[model samples]
Target: MDFNPPPYQGTNRILGGKSVTMQDVAEAAGVSISTVSRVLDERLPPSRSKAAERVRKVAQELGYRRDIMASSLRRGGTGTIGVLVPRLSDMVMALVYEAVFRAAERHGYFAIVATSGDDPAQEQSAAESLLDRRVDGLILATSRLDDQLPAQLRQRQIPHSLILRTDGVSRSALGNDEQGGYLATRHLIDLGHRDIGLLAGPNFTSSARDRQRGYRRAMNEAGIPVREEWVCESGYGIEAGESVGYSLLTRENRPSAVFAINDDLAIGVMAAAHRVGLQLGQELSLVGYNDIPLVARLPIPLTSVHVPFDHVAALAVELLLAPTEPSDPIRRVMPTLIPRASSTPPASS
Candidate 1:
């Protein structure tokens, strides 16, 4: 018996119950397979040439979906990006991961995430597990000030980009944290708040440290003395905020306004104020960062610094996939301050 494949039917072979392949599209469009591949690749910029247009039209009509998994294997890649975060419980981290996922999809890549619990050992372990799965690259939002993972990944010739926080030596994409901090603090100052308190996040991360710097800069520029007792180092959580906030609020000369480095912290402070019988936006104004969705829906809407997570995610993926090292290793997207009812002139003013 002869063992030969059937002749190529026309590109409109959907009726045959067979998956439309790139070869079929190429044949239908009267183009080479290579041309079809390039035209259909979402990772590359779309082409406006007549041949490219014809290929796309044919692919669409034929219902040809690129087999990402098979193509990735052919190209010696997994076509997947691994994302590392402290934890998804944090709204900010969840937002960043979601943004990264969407950005990866736009680039024809898949993304997976793992939590490190903000521990260095666990961070390395999670990274290694992802790498073992043969992911094409990594996007880490868990980097600490003295993180060794970035350096280790570099030495191993791995492609990765840091997000949210950085060690200063790696390729990074994040918001201008210092500017965000300054904006949050300056808004309170402009609202006639002189005795301002700070719910500063942990000092281990660059984001927290930079934001504190911005806070200091704003205070110094306004000729306001920053009292040592007013700046409290805390975790990036509501519980931490509440604990530190209670301490700050119960002081003899408590601040009338508080700037929490993140929305969670701000919410925590709000809770603390409630327990102490302080009315927000009147007796005790509050500001937060990363303007997560929940803040706007509160009883007294929170004023927060809105970080553009999508922009940061896109930049991170681009930086990770870049063939050559970028001259500017660190990229910072500017944040916007969204004022709400939570921030207002102090009752005394």
Candidate 2:
């Protein structure tokens, strides 16, 4: 029996074993280990042009793959960013996360996301887990006014930026919730809607409070009496909206229009309207915020406030990655009103 090894095919040989390291390339190229490191890492100055070229060639031939984890460790960074969101099931949060993920990739950084289910304790736990992974920074979409997570992060001097929500003490990227509310309410008032209900979000969130403030301001400016009973504060969800909508619509003297703080609530209100035998845009007008895609496809297209998810995500990432402190004083992005079939002048009695 002849004992001999088969000839090595380039592709097969390259795929057969462990990943090729910089040391292997350096030895093959007859260069110092440090020279290989500097060349492969793109840290070699222009002074070593020829040496870099040679190292590059050797690395390519040897199929050397740089260990990014090891390299980042040496540089005291993980080249990773952790994003915390309330929940991924919410279209708004999902879109924002997608934007952040793509934006991070464009800037040569990797992004990881963890959901907190909108629980403060869960958020803290998730944050600690991300920190354990040595993430260089964080982008938080779960900032609540009374939440101490942002304060803790500030105390630790951890690089972070708030997105969609704010604690007011740290840097944040947010939509102009008050302006959005005002726009929606003013549109209804202009259409002869003196009796308007508001489906506001929870009080703990600055967004909810700001939007409610805008609603009040608009109503007050128009000389319309804001019925205390017409304002309902609840969780940011369709079920919450449905419950509130049913309560308002079933009352003896229901408002002619409602401005929900988000599309989910508006959708729920629509459901209530259907159940109450009210014709949308005719008997009852409705407006929503966050103009999410689902609102457009409704049987009656929803009038909504458009929050710029992409813009907010990009700006938040930029703020998080800035080498120096962000100097831009104005951090809120303005929202626009989109009119659709869901809102119209109240039907004349």
Candidate 3:
């Protein structure tokens, strides 16, 4: 009766004494600090339930809290994944980044994202920054096919996954770019449009090259001449599409059908056609790729190709985590053509 729990003489009653710590609790509990931590974190063995609960209660009475950062350092892993993208503002990149984040979080890894603005030098700099932070892995969509990043990454021993565009060094993923192009272009041809124009992206990118090739192949198979003047090369954004659209529409002989590399270009081209007093889907048939979410809700719905960002992104992250030896390099997601209000048969049809 005189020994009533030692009168609660613990030095950490106010939680600022730094008196009793995880170590003290581990000693009293007859276990390692890691075991105590796991028990407190609800990650320990089921058989230790009663004892774990007692340990947690004692730790609380001891005013003990685990230092997660210090524990991670002890394990030599930051439990973080570095993510690099050219630009998150772009719809495709935005979708891919969000997917990467969800996947990373599933595997108990936090994602640290950075943007390189599509510059090679800047991409390298961003990668270096991520490495300096001691990320366990990286997921990158900023490298070009022939860029030195792949080689450099190997030299630096960075376990990474390539997304969208590849530097050809490791497991990677991509949408059905050529198929998307062919689908968009073939839809126009099937609508009785023989005189078709292609709004191509910058020549430096694999996307622009592949999409343009698919367009040309579609026309060639249909025996329609792919006119040099009708194929306009420009940057792959709204502004680039707008400028080229104006030029193509005002030409001596305008195309009856137009195919843009992506949705933004298609939107811009539609604006151009309207400014010139032409009705879309009637006076001029138009199509585009990368069926962005907003395309369906537009004033005039766009006929476009849909790229599955979810599947592609998941595969990319899986590759980074697994890194199978001689991993199958041919992984690719399919694309679908969405026919909307933006295209119609030529007048002759």
Which candidate ranks first by lDDT, i.e. highest? 1
Candidate 2: misplaced stretches above 4 Å?
1-71
Per-residue lDDT of model 2, residues 1-349, tens digit only: 8532221111212533655665677778898776676565432243457878887888787777665566556667987999999998888899999989988876657899999987899999999999999999999999888899999998999999999888777888899888889999999999889999999979988889999999999999999989999999989988988998999999999999999999999999999999999999999999999999999999899999999998998889888877787777238999999999999998993
Give per-model TM-scores: 0.91, 0.81, 0.79
For candidate 1, the TM-score is 0.91
lDDT of each: 0.91, 0.86, 0.79
Using lDDT as the measure, name the better of candidate 1 and candidate 3. Answer: 1
Distance from true position, residue 317, model 3, in Å? 0.5
Better of 2 and 3 by TM-score: 2
Where does candidate 2 clash, by residue pair? none
Model 3, residue 102: what's the lDDT?
A: 83
lDDT winner, 2 or 3: 2
Best by TM-score: 1
Q: Is candidate 1 or candidate 3 better by TM-score?
A: 1
Write model 3 residue lDDT over 1-89, tens digit each, in one string: 33211111123444544566667887877776656656654222344577787777778767765554554455567868898998878
Clash pairs detected, candidate 1: none
